[model samples]
Target: MAEIEVYTERYEREHGHKPVGRRFWSFTIVSPIATAKDHFLHTEQAMTYDKALEKAMEVAIKRRSERIIVEP
Candidate 1:
């Protein structure tokens, strides 16, 4: 399995109040190859960091499973 890291970024809207509503959560999967072509998970929106992490992990697992089948 690829190592995954989750990060959160604050979202700022042009026409709204300061801070805005929800934030964006993203994840990056470390590449196994020497080229280091990492995979990224970008979500539409997330209320909390935990939620974002969960979504990212889910996607990573699914992708890993698919890759295993293809490689095997």
Candidate 2:
């Protein structure tokens, strides 16, 4: 099976928090077999990059494991 790849990006928006605003982190999981035109299997957002990445990895593992199971 191909390994799943995780990508993260940080976005800042205007809000009432810090001087520059708040920073939001988003994560996207890309399948190894996916093409440029293909969409990511999962996407998630969190207050911190680590949290977002953790969630993304969890989802990716779950999805990959499910694909390996046989339905009776």
Candidate 3:
């Protein structure tokens, strides 16, 4: 089983400010092992944390991760 780290957050990349009010969403995933390359994935489809988490989980699934560390 592989352990992976996923960082998900919502922010407006253009202004680089907080309290972006659900304007943008992005996530970064990292694996401690070489199960998969560490990278970032961004999507505008996610308006809430649940949606963002869903996408992150998909990546984890592809990596066959059994354990995951998620950060908001």
Candidate 4:
């Protein structure tokens, strides 16, 4: 239903000592559509914070984005 362009660059936070052999992945998703009315970012002006978050999660689920494993 909702879609976003995810950045290839991944950010990570190391959880030292507390958890071993566990990795964290952070991804940034941006809107692909650019419009003059929305001032370039359609997703921001078109949807509320809750709505945008919901859509982002939906997109992630649909794409099975959690399966991604990046190696340093």
Q: Give the distance in Å from residue 38's predicted Cα in candidate 3 to where it truly belongs.
A: 6.1
lDDT string, candidate 1, 24-71, tens digits: 744564335313344655669655655765665665676552221000
Clashes of each: 0, 0, 0, 0
Q: Evaluate model 3: give its TM-score.
A: 0.46
lDDT of 1: 0.45
Clashing pairs in 3: none
Cα distance off (Å), candidate 4, residue 15:
24
Clashing pairs in 1: none
Per-residue lDDT of candidate 2, residues 1-72 (tens digit): 656543211222233232122234433434444354432432333244455445556655755522211001
Q: Candidate 3: which stretches are off by over 4 Å?
A: 1-21, 32-38, 65-72
Better of 2 and 4 by lDDT: 2
Query: lDDT score of model 4?
Result: 0.34
lDDT agreement with native, every candidate: 0.45, 0.37, 0.51, 0.34
- Tens digits of per-residue lDDT, candidate 4, 1-72, equal 333333322323332222123233222332233233322112334444345445555545554343222212
The candidate that achieves the highest lDDT relative to the unseen native structure: 3
Clashing pairs in 4: none
Task: Give the candidates in order of TM-score, highest first.
Answer: 3, 1, 2, 4
Q: Give me candidate 4's TM-score against the actual structure.
A: 0.31
